[model samples]
Target: MASTSSNKSRCATCGKNIGTFTCRGCSQDFCLSHAQEHRQLLGKQMDEDVILMHDQFQQCLNEQVKQPSLHPLMKEINEWEKQSIEKIQLVAQVARQKVLNIISKHTDNVIIALTSIKEQLSRARDDDDFFESDINEWKENLEKLKTDLNTPKAITIKFDDKMNSFIPKISVHKERPITERFERFLGDIQIEENGQLITHGNSNAHATVRGKGEYSSGQRLFRFKIENKRTS
Candidate 1:
């Protein structure tokens, strides 16, 4: 009889007395009066739990679906971005090529222009040499004329008034002895401050000599001594 009472004290679901009912679906037990109500409450709670679980499962599935759908769109967007970058690079390359071509053309034109200018400059330099030669020839002719004009000479000529009008008026010459002329021409020869000998005389009697340390041949020398002449 004591074993029977002890067995009746056990819970119906888990067969242990934990002092409360637990639903079967949720692994809970109930007393005699609350058994039916507990079963009904458990059935209602199981239905609500199943609906909640289904909602969670459907949410997970919807998230998975959205992830797959977004993957293709993301791939398309990335591909479009890559394509746009490549197109931009291609356009930049073309523009760079065009700029380089223009620069090359400009450089070529500059080179050609410089070549032409160089050619013109060469021609001008050649012409300058020709002019220089002409100037040198003229200078030599002038030196020769100067030497001839300075030569001492005596001439007897009747001058007409018309010829005198065209001719330059010059002072009459004072005759001196040849020795006296020579002495006068040589008397004033002196070494200047710059160590160059300076002679003061008529154009035909002028003479000069460089200093003792400096001398060269072909330097200017003149003599204006006349021979004996009877008084007219």
Candidate 2:
């Protein structure tokens, strides 16, 4: 009876006796012409809705990329990394200069000493008669040179082969770890209608508002005051 009764339903749009199809959403019957018109109207509404959604989403993404309020930790950490690297570079430069200075000083001393020994040997060769005093002096000089060879000459800068192993081997970089943490947090932060956070299973996140009262998405997603920071 329900099926037979439904067959006799009137078109809601044209008020005609025969209906080609029934709309489940509005729960209304419509004639063929009205049904087609209704479908076209719905299709237009859907297109408009899709376009609006795409525009809003694109705007949101653009705002986040171009002018987002950068995280304080991220900025601070980047600065820290730059400063630390600069400091290390300065220290390395100082160390390198010191090494060069020591090498120059020690090399000059050794060269002068060798030159004096050479001159004394030439004089000894010229004088065939070996004076007892000269023989003793040359022997003493030779012994001194042998001792100098054993004595540590300004610690030669040979890097410890094992030093590389002792340096810190971090599995994750400083900013990289923070970025990974934020990436995981990204999944939890869902901006809902009117700039609200949507909470799902195990998500207990909250958005902090600074410098003012509550904001509503009237025209844009929310309202906020933007000011240029001035440094004195």
RMSD list, candidates in order: 34.1, 36.0
Per-residue CA lDDT of candidate 1, range 102-199, in tens? 55554564566556655655776787644775457546655654453343122112334555564332222222212212222244354443432344
Work out candidate 1's RMSD over C-alphas.
34.1
Model 1 Cα displacement at 220 (Å)?
64
In model 2, the Cα lDDT at residue 93 comes to: 78
Separate clash counts for every candidate: 4, 0
Give all TM-scores, in the order shown. Answer: 0.24, 0.30
- Candidate 1 residue 184 Cα shift, in angstroms, is 79
Cα lDDT computed for each candidate against the true fold: 0.51, 0.59
Q: Give the residue spans of candidate 2 off by over 4 A.
A: 1-60, 63-75, 128-152, 156-232
